[model samples]
Target: MSEGPLYPPPGAPTPEEPAAGPPAQPAHPAYPAPGTTPPPAGWAPYPGAAGGPRPGLALGAAHKPGAFALRPLGLGDMYDGAFRIIRFNPKATVGAAVLVTAAAMVLPLLVTAVLSFTVGLALDESGEIETSASTSEVLAFLAAYGSLLLSLVLAQIGITLVTGMIVHVTRAAAVGRRLSLGEAWAATRGNRWRLIGLVTFLYVAFVVVLVVYVLLWVLVVALADGPWPVVVWGLVSVPAYLALTCWMWVRVYYLAVPALMIESAGVFGAIGRGWVLTRRAFWRTFGIALLTVVIANVAGSMLGFPFSLVGQLATVFTPEYALLALVLTQAVVSVVQNAFTAPFTGAVASMQYLDLRMRKEAYDVELLREAGIISE
Candidate 1:
C-alpha cells in the first residue's frame, strides 16, 4: 500500500538471479515464445508452435530435427528421408542389415556348397552324370535341395526380424534420437514373435491363394470343351490374379510391419491397421512402394553384378574350387545387396507409416511433444 517495498518483503523468498554466464538460449530457438515478437515476414513458423499451423495447414512450417519433418511428406521427402535415415545411423540401419543378411546366408551357403560338391563329384569329366552313381549321391543332392529350401525359409524369417528392427530405428530417428543396434533390438523384444507370425501368415495366405488359383485353372481346363476356352480362361484369369496379388501387397501388407512395431499390435491387428491406414490413400501408398521396390532392385542388381562376374570367372579359371568360390561370392553378394536394400525399403515403409499417421491423426503434435520440440 505504501509502495515502500519495491521488491519482496523482508523474509519473503526473493527470486534468484540467473547464474552469471551467457544467457541460456531457448531449447528450441525456432519456436519463439507465445505473444512475443513474431518472426519476420516470409519466416515460416516452427512445427507444433503454439497457435501455429498444423501439418496440412502449412507444410513449410514443419520442423525436421531428424530424418523427416513432422508433417505429411511428399514423394521427394519420403525418398530423401529414407536415405537420411540410413546415413544418420548406419550402425543401427546398414550395420544391422549386413549382420542379419550374413547370418541368413550362412545355411544357404553351406547347403549350396554341399549340393555343388556332391553333384560335382557325381559327374564325370565331361560334366555328365556317371552311370555308376550311388543312391547316396542322389539322396545327398535331394537332401541338399531340401536343406536349401529350409535355409530360404530361415532367411525370410531373418529378414522379417530385421525389418522390424529397422522400423524401430526409424521411429527413434523421427524423434531426433539415434538408437544403437542393441537399443533397436531391445525395442523389438515383444514384437519379434508378432512380426514373425505376421510374415508367416502372409506367406501362408499367398500360398493358399496360389493353390486356389491353380485348382480353379485346372477345373477350367477340365471343363472346357476346346483349347480356345482354356486359352480364354488363362488370358482373363492371369492378369486378374496378378492384379489381386499386387493390390493385396501394396494396400494391405505394406504397412503391417510398421503398425506392428510402432503400435505394438498383434499379427492380425497390425494387418487390419495397415488396411485401415491405406483407406483413401491407395494410389499414394502403391506408388511409393512400387518406386521403392524398383530402386532397391536396381541398386541390388548393380551391386551384385560385380560379385556375380567374379564368381563366374573364378568358376571358369578354377574349376576345382568352383563350388566353394561361387558359394562365397554369392554370400558376399547377398550381404552387400541386402545391406543396402533392406534398410532402404524398411525406411521407406516407416516414412509412409509416419506420413499416413500425420495425415490422419495429427500425429505430428505427438511426435513434436515427444521430441521436446514443443511443450506438452
Candidate 2:
C-alpha cells in the first residue's frame, strides 16, 4: 500500500526526495595524502569515498557550543544565571535554599520572641517607659538591632560561600557521577575552611575597593580648586577609574580561590597563579564573565516579571485592597529581588574562575577527563 499522504499513491515527490544518498564527487587530482594518524582533536577531515560518506551518516565528533556570549556583566545578570543553575540542580539549589530560608526566618522570630520576653521583664521591674526604657533601653535596642543585622549579613555571607562551593563541586561531580546527600555534605565540609577564607578575602577586597573609591572621591572634591573645569575633568575620569578598579580586581582575584582550593596554595600564591593563568586573555575573560552576567540578568527578569505583574494587578481594586496590595507588593519585591540577584552571583562564582583555569591551566580538559565525559 502507498504510504498514505506521504507517498501519494506510488511516486509523488516522495516527500522531499526520500532523503538524498551521499553525493558523488570526482577525486581531486594531484592531492598529496597525509601520512600517519594525524593527531587527535586537530583535524581528521572527511574520509575519501567514491561518493563521500552517506549524507545521513553523522560526521566526526559532536562538540559543544563555545562559552556563553560576551556582554557586560551586571547585577541582573547574576540573578538570571543563578536561577538557570537552580533549574538545572533544583535539588541542590532550590531544595537546600528552601531549608536554609526556613531556618533564617524562624531563627529571627525566635530571637524576637526571647527579646520581647526580656523587654516585658524590664517593664515589670521599672513600670515606666521614661524610667524603665529610657536611654538604656534605647541604646539596648540599637545595639540589639545592629548586632542582629550584622550577624544576619555575615551568616548569609557564610551560607552563600558554602552554597557556592557545594554547587560547583556537585556540578563537577554530576558530569561523571552522582552524589548522595551525604557525599555533597562531605565535599562541602572538606572544602569549608578554604571556601570561607576565599570568601573572606573577596569580602575584604570589595571593602578595600570601596574605601579606595571613597578616598578618590574625597580627593577629587577637595582637589577641585573652586571651578567647573576641574570638576568636569574629575567627572570624566570616573569611568576610567571604575574600569581600572574592576580590571585590577579581576586580574588579581579571578581564579585565585579556585586555584587555592584545587592546589592548596597560600593567598599570595593563589593570586599569582590566577594572574598567570588569566594573563594573555584579559578581554576574553572579562567578556565571558560579563556575558554570564547578561544571560543571568535576562533570566532573572524573565522569572521576576510575573510576580511583579501580579503585584501591579492588585492595585486596580480599592483602598482596602491597596493595603493588601502593599503587603503583596513588598513580598513580591523581596522575592524578585532575591531571585534576580542570586543567579548571576552563582554564575560568577562558577564561570569566571572556571574559565580562567581552563584557559590558563588546561583544567577544562582535566575536568572533562575527570568526569569521564572524555578520555584524552
Candidate 3:
C-alpha cells in the first residue's frame, strides 16, 4: 500500500486504538456506559453522566423509547403497556374501537328491530300468539331471524378487524410511533381476512367440540341405568371437558391473532406460531391471558352497571316503553364495553407476543437496532 499519511485517515483507527469490534462490555453489565452505543433517536442523556448520558443510553435503566422498556416485560409492564398504547394513540385504539363496534352493532340492532316488529305482528292485542298467522308473516319472521344470525356472523368479522387494528396500534406504539386510525387500518388491511378466517375456524372448532362432548354425555347417561351413573358421569366428564377446552383455548388460540397480525402469518401458520411460542410456558401464558380477560370483563361490567340500572329503572317506571328503553340501554352498554375491553385485550395480547419473543428470541436487541439505538 502507499505510505500512510502522518496520522490515520479521519475515520480510521490508529495504531494505539483497537479496531472497532463488538461493543465493549460495560463494567456494570446491566447499565452500559452511554458512549458505547448511541442512544435512540430523541433520547435524552442519563442524568449525571460524564458529560450527559449519551443519546442512546437509557437514563437509569433499560431503554424504553416507547410504551415499554426494550426488555422482557413483567406483568406490570404488560398491563401498563396496554394502557399506554391506548393513551398514547387514542385515535388509533379507542376511536377505531368505537367506530368498529358501532358498525358491527348496526346490523344486529336493525335485525333485532325488524324481528321485534315481525314478532309483534304475530301477537294479538292481548299479547297472545295469533293462531291464524298467515304464511307471509311466518316467512317474514323466519327471514328476520335468519338475517339476525347473519348479522351476528358479520359482527364477529368486524370484531376481528378491530382486534387486528389494535395489534397494529400496539406494534407501532412499541416503536415510539403513534399510528392514526387510517394508518392502523392500512397496516391491518392485508391481514383482515386471515384474522377473520382464524376466528371463524376457532369458533367452529369450539362448537364442534362442545357438540361432541354433549353427545358423549348424553350417550353415557343413556347407556347407564342408575341416577348415580349420571351424577358420576357428570362429575368426571364435565371437569374433563372444561379442562380440555380451557387448555386448548389457552395453549392454541391465545396468541393466534397477534401472530397473524404481526407476522403476516396465514391462519394455520398463526396457530402454529402461537403453539410454538407458548411451548414450555403454558401456565404463564394462560395466567396472564385469563387475568387480562377477567380484569377487562370486571371493568366493563362496572362501567356498564350505571346504564343497566338506568334501563331497569326505566322499565320499572315506564312499562309501555320498556322495550325501547332496554334496547337503548343495552346498545349503550355494548358500545362502552366493546370500546374499552376490545383495545385493552388487544393491547395485552400484543404485549404478550412481544414479551414472549423477547424472552425466547432475543428480540429486544433487534428492536433496539430497529429503533436506531444501535448499528446493524
Assess every candidate by TM-score: 0.79, 0.57, 0.77
> Where is model 1 more than 4 Å wrong at Cα?
1-62, 108-132
Q: Single out the weakest 10-residue window by summed lDDT for candidate 3.
A: 1-10
Cα lDDT, model 3, residue 32:
41
Across residues 1-376, which tens digit of lDDT does each residue of candidate 3 receive? Answer: 0111111111234224234454322211134465666544322211121232225434443367567777888899899789877766677788877776667567646754665555543444443335687777566556655654565466557767888988877765665545656667766766777888899899889999999999998898889988999998899988999899888887778899988887777899889989999999898988998999999999999999999999978767765444445556766787788778989999998889988989998878766655545555
Clashes of each: 0, 12, 5
lDDT, each prediction: 0.72, 0.47, 0.70
Evaluate residue 288 in candidate 2 and report its C-alpha lDDT on the 0 to 100 scale.
63
Q: How much is 107 displaced in model 1, in angstroms?
A: 3.0
Across residues 272-374, which tens digit of lDDT does each residue of candidate 1 receive? 9899999999988998899999999999999999999998788677776555565678678878888889999999999999899999988787777655556
Error of 3 at 364 (Å): 1.0
The top-ranked prediction according to lDDT is: 1
Q: What TM-score would candidate 1 get against the native?
A: 0.79
Regarding TM-score, does 1 or 2 come out ahead? Answer: 1
